[model samples]
Target: MVVYAISIYCSITNDDSNLLVHEYMPNGSLWDRLHTYKKAEMDWNVQYKIAMGAAKGLEYLHHGCDRPVIHQDVKSSNILLDEEMKPKIAEFGLAKIMQTNKVTNSSHVIAGTYS
Candidate 1:
């Protein structure tokens, strides 16, 4: 799940207006494919692979990083598929960077999708 951040642009007139660019994923998201097509459309092996990949990504974020990053919005829709059908976690807008020595962080507000 390598992200190549090409560039960032911001409007001088509007501080709120900003844009970020990254590499494109051809296969879209796992949620889209699962919802758009029948379960039979995707073989069991492929499904298992996707699931494992997502789990590994989450594992790395939680345990592998120098500073643990909590992906606050982990869901089917946020799991993107690359051209090879490999799972890539996306959407870190709600991610929380926890202290290295702390196992958890207290938050006043709740975030992420219910579904």
Candidate 2:
């Protein structure tokens, strides 16, 4: 499992807030590498590693964990890269923990951006 630096939940002025801290990813997101960053040319091996890491992370979330976590918004931007270009899944704001035995899950409104 990818270890996060720290997570804190606190209340300030009657308002609740949550914070999650992680190591700085110098390489930024995969989206930035592919679309925004100039001179960003990821080799085939690096790309393969990132793909495998992402797959393992998703596997852990879906089948390895006690409760299946569904990442509602999965996009290139959500895949963060460490200094070594290792991929780590981020941005779980739209994530959902489904009941293990539940056959189906439903939502009233759609979440996430279309484009």
Candidate achieving the largest lDDT: 1
lDDT of 2 by residue, 22-93 (tens): 556788887888886532578789889888888887877778768888887777888888878888788787
Tens-digit per-residue lDDT, 55-86, candidate 1: 88888888877898788888888888877778
Q: Which residue pairs in candidate 2 have backbone atoms (N, alpha carbon, C) closer than 3 angstroms, thus clashing?
A: none
Q: After superposition, how far is residue 104 of candidate 1 from its true place, in Å?
A: 3.2
lDDT of each: 0.73, 0.72
Model 2 Cα displacement at 101 (Å)? Answer: 2.3
Give the lowest summed-lDDT range of ten residues in model 1.
3-12
Clash tally, candidates in order: 0, 0
Deviating ranges (above 4 Å) for candidate 2 = 1-17, 105-110
